[model samples]
Target: MKIFQSTTHYNYDWEHVSTANWQKYSPWNEKTPHVIAVDTLSRHVDPASGVLRTERLITCEQNCPKWLTAILGGDSKSQVYECSYVDPKSKTLTLCSHNMTYADLLSVRETVVYTPSAHNPESNTQFTQTAKITAFCGGWQKIKNKIEQFTVDRFVENAAKGREGFEMVLERAREVFAQERERMEMSQRA
Candidate 1:
């Protein structure tokens, strides 16, 4: 098994960052071209905690090596099951996801969290992400190690791109919100 962890800070408020999370895969985010589609399976708000819970199915096209594709039965597309929790009271967003495709041969579980930065809670958000990779091919220790390492490397590279894509979305969302605020102010003045 291989474990990967990362921490990043976004120069945006937690509320904006959290809202942008949902638009990470928007068409405007060119950095996430691998993401083909995202579908919401379920969503509900917890009355007691005022937390929103959501389930989603994500489909991604992977650029895997020919050898890897052959080993995995020639499938280049991957599906992931993701669940997210948005706690309004705590001002935190958490996402957990696992690969559904090729689960028998390899497993990848990932978790991400977004919260207000301690240094500047009102203007910055802290992002933390972790992933575990494991290969289940029996009696092939060398191959398993190679698979795990490859996955870890890919995850790290993708993590950077994901952050870039999300940043773009956040910037756009902030612009839209600013425009809306200006409109409201003008209307009120009128």
Candidate 2:
């Protein structure tokens, strides 16, 4: 078993960062070539708490080590089940995801949270992520450790790329918003 944890800050506010989360897999994020598709399984707002809950299935191209792929089979894609909660009142977003493919041999579970940064609450957002990797291979401690470590390393690399991609998306979103606001102002003046 292995655990990976990371924390970072986004220059954008919580609202914009939260909005960008939904567009993370959009075409703007070319850094995530592995991600192929995302399907929303369900979505609804909780009447009591006024929180939004969503479930999705994400599909990605398999990019495993040759030896690992040999053991897992010839499949070329992997799937993940993700659930998210958005508390608008609290300005927090939390996402939990688990690997749905090859669970018998290995498992990866990840949780991510986005919230207003303490240092700059109004203009900055904090991002926190944690992942647990476990190998279920029987009587093979060496293989298990190797798999977990490899996964951890890969995850770290991918996390950085994901951030870069999201940043690009956010920048594009901001530009569009600015243009729209300018147009609205012009129309109002007219």
Candidate 3:
């Protein structure tokens, strides 16, 4: 699976924002060998303001490592940012920024678009220009289900294993401590 770097924003306020030039941030630079873009329309109501906002987020993908580190931070693992929309009506640009680490951004549960690989038809290439148009509603459902199941199973298994290992170590330590205490007691009595 080819993993491409991507930047995404979600607007949940009653405003329309447009990006003038994403390239200015140098998001495409670094180790990214391939670049792709996708956009999605969504809406949400702000609980505090009681304002409904429609947002169209354009996600751009790149394979450059340096660019990824600059945007997401660290050595480029994966990242996602839940940003507040800035209504700059003058510039027609919505500003979204987050104070998060690369790992934190990678943990955002955003929609993923899967595309067919051009270089190798058999490969399940995860990035493509066509992803913007494909119906992703159904695919996201499947991906979410699998992720939930896997995460639950992994945590359960690890927790059980950790408890068992801790018990074993505790038992061994108890035995050693008891023996040492008994020897000290006998020497004092003599």
Candidate 4:
């Protein structure tokens, strides 16, 4: 079992980042090699906290590290997960997830939190993703380095793509809010 922690900061408020995570659809038509598709199985909202929970089959393209692919028994299928997006309050939001399909051969539980920056609270969001991995097989040490390096690479790639998608969503949200505000102001003047 291995645990890895990574943190990424975004130059936006927590709400903006959280909203993007929930609603943003990337420009996936451009062909995302690592992520092929996302299929939602079931979802519900927590009335009390307003957290959105979902079960999904995430079709990851066959781009895994060679060693990891070998570990997956050379199967050609996607991974499924049960995930949740926590409600936003003040300046923070959290996303939690657990893997379902690979529970025996592998296990993963991750928590990603988005928080506002202290220095510029209104202008920045801090994203921290912590992932725990467990491999239920022997001979793991032989390919430990490959596993670690691949994990790091994926972390970076995901962050880059996530940032792009989040920014587009946040910008669109701002534009819509601005338009609404202007409309309300004009009506008041009339």
TM-score to native of every candidate shown:
0.95, 0.94, 0.27, 0.68
Across 87-147, the per-residue lDDT of candidate 2 in tens digits comes to 9999999999999998887899999999999999999999999999998878999988998
Q: What is the C-alpha lDDT profile of model 3 across 64-104, one tens digit per residue?
A: 35864676455533222333242333222332322123322
Per-residue lDDT of model 4, residues 16-115, tens digit only: 6676665554452232455566778788877887666666666765454577567666654556564655555444566666666556755667787788
lDDT of 1 by residue, 92-150 (tens): 99999999988888899999999999999999999999999999979999999998998
Q: What is candidate 4's TM-score against the reference? A: 0.68
How many pairs in model 4 have backbone atoms within 3 A of each other, for residues 3 or more apart or on separate chains, i.e. clashes?
0
Off by over 4 Å in 2: none
Score each candidate by Cα lDDT.
0.92, 0.92, 0.35, 0.65
- lDDT comparing candidate 4 with the true structure: 0.65
Once fitted onto the true fold, the runs of candidate 4 whose alpha carbons sit more than 4 angstroms away are 28-36, 45-55, 64-77, 100-103, 176-190
Worst 10 residues of 1 by lDDT: 65-74
Deviation (Å) of 9 in candidate 4: 2.6
Better structure of 2 and 4 per lDDT:
2
- Clashing pairs for model 4 are none
Candidate 3 achieves a global lDDT of 0.35
